[model samples]
Target: MIEGRMETRTAILRAARTLFLERGYAGASVRSVASAAGVDAALPIHYFGTKQALFLEALPSMPDYQPLLEGDPDDLGERFVRYVLEEDGHLRPLYLTLLRASDAGAVGEQLRDLHETTFVAPLESRLAGQDAELRARLAAAVVGGLMYALWVVGDDQLLAKGEDDIIRRYGALLQHLIDDRL
Candidate 1:
């Protein structure tokens, strides 16, 4: 019985993630997750209480960024871009879900918090000289734009660029932001 309950919970979480990514928080219903999980609709409610709760539960934990930060500072931007592109399919839905959330709501706040903790703070620490925070913000903005342009908007010209070209070109731009002086 305990095993079955655990399995059911796992299934619900997986289903919730897929549905949330596919349909967004507002778009993904408890019923839909339940259906996908092969459980009764009440089961999700029983486990998670509310759709918002379930959405939070389903959010992917941030991967350790330490390794990505370990390399030479000059290549950091390229490394970052490589990491971003390597993640291709995984992060698309995450950002998509963020966009789907209402800016004034709980989900939006959660996403914002995640962005700062998982992104900005780390970069701020790495950056040196005047206006580190501003530099970090600009660098983070470029990263966000790359994600939106390549994955979210699915721009052909930008997406079509070879990995080496991106690492050479976009990486340089990001690095410039990271080294901002004024």
Candidate 2:
């Protein structure tokens, strides 16, 4: 019985990730995920509590930015850019999923909260200046655009460019913000 329950939970989670990716959070429903998983709709509710909870659970775990934060302040931008471009393959889907569903009602709220907590707040704490919050937000926006262009739109030109070039250019932009030069 325990094994059966575990399988059911795993199946539901797998289906949720697939449907949520294919159709944004607004479009993907517990019913649909349950259907895809071959489970009763109530099972998802029972295990995950709510669609928001399920969505959060289905997302890839957030990468730890602590190491990036601890690195040399001068190299923070390059570190961030390199981490996203090279090490954060698992996070691509999460960015797309959040972006696509951002305009939806509760998901919008969730996205805002996630953005603040995950990206803005930590970076904000590291920044020095009266406009630290604004700078962090601006940097976050650049990161978002980069992810969207690379993963969602699949910009061929950008994709064709070497990673080093992107790291240098984007890193400088982020570094400017980090340094409060802008």
Candidate 3:
């Protein structure tokens, strides 16, 4: 029963994410998420309490970073660069939706909290004792910048380039900086 419930919750989150991304948060509705999840509208409310809560639950999963970082952290810089450049097209929609929703004040606070807790705090912990604050800020900036750049690339043809090419060209520079600095 517990496992089934967990799966249902996960499904709701996944569906909510897809719908929220497809139709900005303001455009997405509980009914849409429920229909996407193949569950009734009340189920999402029962599991997540609100659409904002559902969006927050799905935020961490948006970038799908686990596979990229699951292996050796030693090659993280290259892998990170590759992951974003390759997967950016698929991931940009979510970021666009989130940014729009965030700007609209629909989910700004929750998004900020999610970012601070999940990304900033973790980066701070990892870089502790080695210019912790600066490192944390840099890490956040790099990640956010990468996402934003990818978003821009979606609309701007002048920035056209493949993921592997981007990684091959700039990965070493970025990696060296990260490695040498920390």
Tell how far residue 137 is off in model 1, in angstroms: 1.4
lDDT of 3 by residue, 1-182 (tens): 99988888888888887787778878888888888888877999999887777777765454545455355645667776776666646666766777878864547886677667755665455442556656555655776677786574453542466656667655564554445454
Query: Best candidate per lDDT, number?
Result: 2
Q: Candidate 1 — which residues are off by over 4 angstroms?
A: 1-4, 102-104
How do all the candidates rank in terms of lDDT, highest first?
2, 1, 3
RMSD of each: 2.1, 2.6, 4.7
Pairs with backbone N, CA or C atoms under 3 Å apart (clashes), candidate 1? none
Tens digits of per-residue lDDT, candidate 2, 1-182, equal 99999999999999998999878788899999999999998999999988988887886666667778777879888888888888645687777888887776677787888888878999999999779999999999988888888888889899579899999999999999999998
- The segments of candidate 3 whose C-alpha lies over 4 angstroms from its true place after superposition are 1-15, 34-48, 58-75, 88-93, 104-106, 124-130, 152-162, 180-182
Query: Which candidate tops TM-score?
Result: 1
Q: RMSD of model 3, in Å?
A: 4.7
Please state the error at residue 77 of candidate 3 in Å: 2.6
